[model samples]
Target chain A: MVVAVAEESRGADHARPWIDQAKSDYWQLIDTEHRLEDLYNLVNVPQAIWIDEKGTIVRPPETAGSTDHFRRMDLKTRTLLPKDQEERLAARQAYVDAVRAWVTSGKHALSANAVRANLPRITPEMAESRARFRLGVWLRANGRAAEGDRQMAEASRLYPDSWSMWRQAADLDEVGKASSPAFWKRVQALGDKPYYPPPKF
Target chain B: MTKILTPTAEHDVAARDGLWMSPADAERVTGWTLKPEGMCRAEACVPLPASAVGTNEVDLAAFWARLGGPVIASDERDVWALGAPADERNATLEGLAAPDFTLPDVNGVPRSLSQLRGKKVFLATWASW
Candidate 1:
């Protein structure tokens, strides 16, 4: 089953259109609050975690997009796009190729130790940021917009590298639009950072 | 009806008819569950006093405060915001298991990651933006 962990604020209303249009058979769960970021240690979208049947996470969260994702446009337009586009794409393909290898190799895939070592590095600061983000989401969800903004801003400040958290927090200020110009500016600033930590194969 | 809010889900828990869903709702709102020991998310567990659980309800404020995660309550006592426990979250990072959580589908029916244990889940989090 393909599980889709959407942002905390968007429920089925944001996702149902795409699924309905495709007539998808798989499960597309909606996250009303955006809790998946903390649990999965996700900082951005199109990231994935590979878990074996034993309920153990084989591959930690990392940027994994189809090569086609980058083929269409130049990174110059998509300011949020990672700077190391080709290098990241190669890493994504390597990870995909590794997945194919794992599907065939099963328990014998590459080196288990290497996979185990691939878990995303979560520092104490990250944990605190996640907790702050959760509180921010909850505060905003409960009609306390100002408090929510304060907390979300703190979370974003704690981890400026995570565009997801930053973007989510920025969305709180918009009236009707999806994002404000400030969000794009933030993305432009993040254009040079290790936006998506290069995938590990 | 108590409204439990989380980053991914929200639940209006009615008075229990047979099974008490407060803990389930709590876990849905936060990644922690009320086990026999206490509120548990993964390898870590926070022990709650006997008073925290009533016959068919859980005190969200009490539970939240006890968990040692930042929690703020509204004046009306209807809404509560829960923060993730720092130590438990750190343990989750250390253990490397995605914390289990149940969320509703587009139709508002509940689904959990644990139920799909044997299947390969390509969980992707996206938004309109």
Candidate 2:
């Protein structure tokens, strides 16, 4: 029997097609359950945990399978360029391969700390940037548009090229009454990187 | 050192629920922030719009509803409050032993986690919206 955990955020609607494809291809797809606000708890996508017959977590949290809808050209060698894109792509590919290995070999085949040890180190700046991002989201959600914008601006300064940051800033601007076309344009100007589409309202 | 509140704390407070949280609460306890990403104590991060930085409160309703999260509400001081369980379908706490829960499937038949015991359960989540 197989149980699957689907961590859904606002934009998860866009992932449905790809998830369906994964179910058809790799997994038996027995049960699909949704976890709300799970991303904030689970941190990474495609996280998988294996439970033994006694309901003990046999395998700790690990990055599981992923859906890659984009082609090589879509991610690599894309139009608006960033030098880090290549590195990011390579890391993703490697991570995917590692997950595939885990699925095929099971827990015994791989060391438990293998995945955890390989995770990228979190820098103080990155942590601060993430905090500011959350603050911005919280502010906008609570109807504090200007405060949210300020937090978003700080995020951009810290992680200038992050698609996640830009997308968020755009969301705040679009939702609040203070939203402006110019703000949307600024978000668009951040240039196309491989960004997960926002969930439809 | 200044007290730091987990993302979840800010969220709970912003939601107007009196889910009390102390500033010294560890990230793991709150399950609100992760090492690299913004997750709660359970190490889950919902990809919401925002940089995951400074005082940004995510729209919990939007994020949870999209993810099919089970909305659990409580009333404190005459205000209706809402919170997303660690497990949406099962409504279990994170990092703890899985709780015994039974729910009807699309066919309206009841199923429980205990029934699936002994087999390695690979729970995968999905949604329509």
Candidate 3:
């Protein structure tokens, strides 16, 4: 189950062409309201959860095959250096191997206790930020764009970790700010912190 | 009229004195209904504080906070968002049940997580951005 967390209809429409090109057989859904953020505490794209036959969450959200290597890539050419590309591919391959092993024999599934331990802690400020984000989306949809923008800014201020919340407002229109100079600035701001914390395998 | 935003829906109802809505509107805004004993949804009921209940309206902020949820209102007081508590949202983690959601596929057809029951799911989220 692959879901595109595009908070607005225009964003979803923009992805339609590429989704159509994929020609994949799996379920591809669109979440225009960003429901997964509130429901699962997802903070970034390419995050994944593993569910078993009985609907139990065998694994909590984790960065699935994504790395921060792009930050070091050449922006003008939009390409990673060969060595970095190799490292990125190997990391992604390892994640894919784990997924395959788990799907094949349920070999890598975490125990329920482990799953609980892996779940993200939901703080009061994070919850309030989500509420503010919702209100911002509503305000934007209801002809109050400036108020909505302010609401979203406050939401980002309340929970700085949620880039998903930040990006929705920053990239509300066509040209995306997901990879703008501002985004890179924020990334560079994380001097000692890892951008994508490695999954606990 | 005050607009209350829930996870699933947006409700416009008459409000007074800080998010007090009629019992019927409260139920509509939130799934929980105000009863003689307390506010209830499904089989769960939490007794409301006396001050939270008025002659004809329930104090939404008070009752929501009582349920462990958080309530936030716009500066102008025209819009509010009632958020589910961390406890309720994380219940799926503690209980080991994956939260089920329904979203539209690329073709605009609605699909639900429960529909994929009886199979292993690698639920992944991506962004067009």
TM-scores, each model vs. reference: 0.68, 0.36, 0.93
Give the top-scoring candidate (DockQ): 3
What DockQ would candidate 3 receive versus the native complex? 0.67
Cα lDDT tens digits for candidate 1, A51-99? 6665666767777653333332454676325655666567667766766
> What are the candidates' individual DockQ scores?
0.36, 0.16, 0.67
lDDT of 2 by residue, A1-201 (tens): 554433322233444565656655323221222221122223333455555556655444444443223222232434323544565466567654643544566533323344334323433344445555555554555566686677667755766544335444654455432224453454446466322321111
The true-structure Cα RMSD of candidate 3 reads 2.0
Supply the TM-score for candidate 2: 0.36
The B-chain TM-score of model 2 reads: 0.30
lDDT of 2 by residue, B6-120 (tens): 3243332323222223323323234444333434445466554453222434344343333443322211121112333323412232333444544434333456667887665
DockQ of 2: 0.16
Residues B1-129, model 3: lDDT tens digits: 888888777888999877988899988888789998999999999998798998988998999998778798887998999987877887756788888888788778888889888988898887777
Clashes of 1: 9
Ranking of candidates on DockQ, top first: 3, 1, 2
Candidate No. with top TM-score: 3
Interface RMSD of each: 3.2, 10.1, 2.0
- Residue A158, candidate 3: Cα error in Å is 1.3
Tens-place lDDT per residue, model 3, A1-201, is 443444342446867776888877887788766777788998887788888889998988898898888879887889999999999999999999998989888877998789888889888788888888888888887788888889888888988988887777787633668678888899889887877877778
